[model samples]
Target: MSDKKYLVTGANSKLGKLVISFLLNEYQIKPSQLIATSRNPATLQSLADQGIETRAADYANKDSMVQAFKGVENLLLISMDAVGKRDELHTNAVQAAEEAGVKFIAYTSMPNPDASPVFFAFEHEATEKAIAQSRIPAWKILRNNWYFENLIDFYANVLHTKAWLTASGEGRHAQISRTDLALAAAAALVNSESGKETITLNGPESLTTSEMATLINQVLDISINVVHLSEEALEEQLESFQVPADAIIFATTMDRHLKENKSDGTSEAFEVLTGKKPQLFADWLQENKQSLKAISNA
Candidate 1:
């Protein structure tokens, strides 16, 4: 582990930032042992100030990845935030990693990427295939489920209006915190035991839309009713809020998939890897109450 070099792409992203922090502060890893790359290296000045290597690596540009990944023994290819171009970008990154002599690659992927009913699964599935074909010495696929933080907006809006709107019906999701997922990735990268394995990192418990609302109410001392809207109504509401067309379509489609139980999965995998139980939604909300309260008041 001492001899291996680690690189994390999308270093400016939430998961990437958290992973780097976990490795450096929690694991007491040296700054020289890690490399952080983003499309704009300027965004990573803080990491650079900490003595970590910061470089420019855009997933869409193979040359950038090749340069950023040079001598990197283990690489964490975070799935790009771009929706439509992910497959091409991921392929380019994997190819560049192969060219740069990266011995192992870890990919952040969605739950059941190959067969997920959700609209976002195709690109993840494609990225996984590319990694397999890259033929790096070893690889690990981290199929992370939804983040509990995703509901912050919903909770904020609900606290403001006393109503939580959703098209997802009673579908339940075992969503983990972004911090927990980051810790798990860091655990995998630092430990020598992880290789050629695929693990689903999920929250300790699953909760439905109404159940989640209840949890929020419990923590924040606010009661919000879950209003189940039809798909058309949900779309109309999102459009009224000026959400982009693509995002509206994706959210509605995911709601349909949720109704079919697409995300109803949970595991102890995170605990196994990090030696700590994943944060429960209620617990996370409690820890983050001040921010949520501020948002609610705003």
Candidate 2:
């Protein structure tokens, strides 16, 4: 495995970049053994300058995916950022990897894909099914829960409205950071034994919207009320923020799922993989207080 080539698709993404960081800084893997791919290879010039090969692997362009994946022994398939087109894009990419003789894969997926009520989870579930049906020799499913950074959106909204509006009644989310999830992905790709494995990675604790509001008030030293709304009212609230229609629908749907405890799963997979406990949400907020303040100012 040391000599095998590792390729990360969507390498310019937040999660992808962090995965590369752990693979290099933490694992000390040489750049020559890594390939970073994106639709525009030029965006990865920084990684290219670091001696890692940068390739054009467009999800919409099958030929590029096929050529870029050639000779890749292991693949880290970051989910496509294009929400509506993801299932098709992921299917094409997976087929390309199989045709390129890539034997192993590690996929970043949503928690409880098959059952999750989140709109995007449908595509992830489809991709997982595709991988299962394929002939890939080994695979790992890294089912990452929500990210703490998502609260930044809430922070942004609160900065304007001074209130947190949500349809999520009593549900709490186990939100981990992208950095921790990326480390878990890197570990699975570089170190895990060849087999079928699915790791559900989540934050240490679940916190409801009200609890999140309290955290914000404590961190920012400003009182902000959590306004519970019906699903229809939440849509109107999101619309007031000028949120795009599709995003409003997505948010409301996920909020409904959250109300049902869809995002409430917590696991020690991060500790098991990295030999360290995941950071607490409160601690992450404290550490990023400066940034959070900046967001408030923005």
Candidate 3:
């Protein structure tokens, strides 16, 4: 592990960038020991400037990833965003990692992929299985909950109607910040602990839609009422809002998962990994108040 490097796939993604930053700034992972890979390696110029090797690795092209993964011992496989294409993309990545003889893997995954109600969660479960069956000596699956930043869409949508629609009923789910998730991921990639593990990184607490609306109300100084919808009604409403066909199923199923407490509860595994408690949603709301305010203004 000391002789090889830690590599992060999808170096250009939002979570990927933050994970790299945490590895560098917080964990002090030296540049010589760090590698960043992206489909467009040119976009990682800043990372290259920092002395971290930037390699071109396309998930669609297994050969590129297998080549880029050479000399890499630890891999942080950021979950890809191309919803419809992630299954094949992740399979390619896992195959490449194994071919490259990567020793350990820390994969970012959705919460409870094995039984998640999210429509596309099976992709993550498949990825986890691939990693487990691979030649890697150790693996960690970081099951990240929904990010606090998801409210960007929720807020934008609700401001137009002044009523937040949900099928989650009174279910409370913890929404973490990307930064906190990054810290936890960096720790998982670089920490001394090894062997197969699945850590659920979560926020400090769970809150219902009404509780979240109250916090948003306090910050944005606007009253946003929570409107409970049946699953069918939620689907119809999401369709009415022009949400894509695939996303409607994703959202509706996610709401069902939430209602069933699949994505709820706070986990301390994060504090164990990073020696710091995860951020509070209320605090995140305060820190990003300006952006949230601007959304309403926009």
Q: Rank the candidates by lDDT, best first.
A: 3, 2, 1
* Least well predicted 10-residue stretch by lDDT in candidate 2: 153-162
Off by over 4 Å in 2: 153-155, 239-243
Task: Give me the displacement of residue 248 in model 2, in angstroms.
Answer: 1.5
Q: What C-alpha RMSD separates each model from the true structure? A: 1.9, 1.7, 1.6
Candidate 3, residues 174-287: lDDT per residue as tens digits? 889988998898899998356888888888998887888888888878888888999999999889989998778877898898887887877688888889989888899899
Error of model 3, residue 155, in angstroms: 5.1
Candidate 1 residue runs with Cα over 4 Å from true position:
153-156, 236-243
lDDT of 1: 0.85
- Evaluated with lDDT, which candidate comes out highest? 3
Q: Please, what is the TM-score per model?
A: 0.93, 0.95, 0.95
| Comparing 1 and 2 on lDDT, the stronger one | 2
Error of 1 at 5 (Å): 0.8
Model 2 TM: 0.95
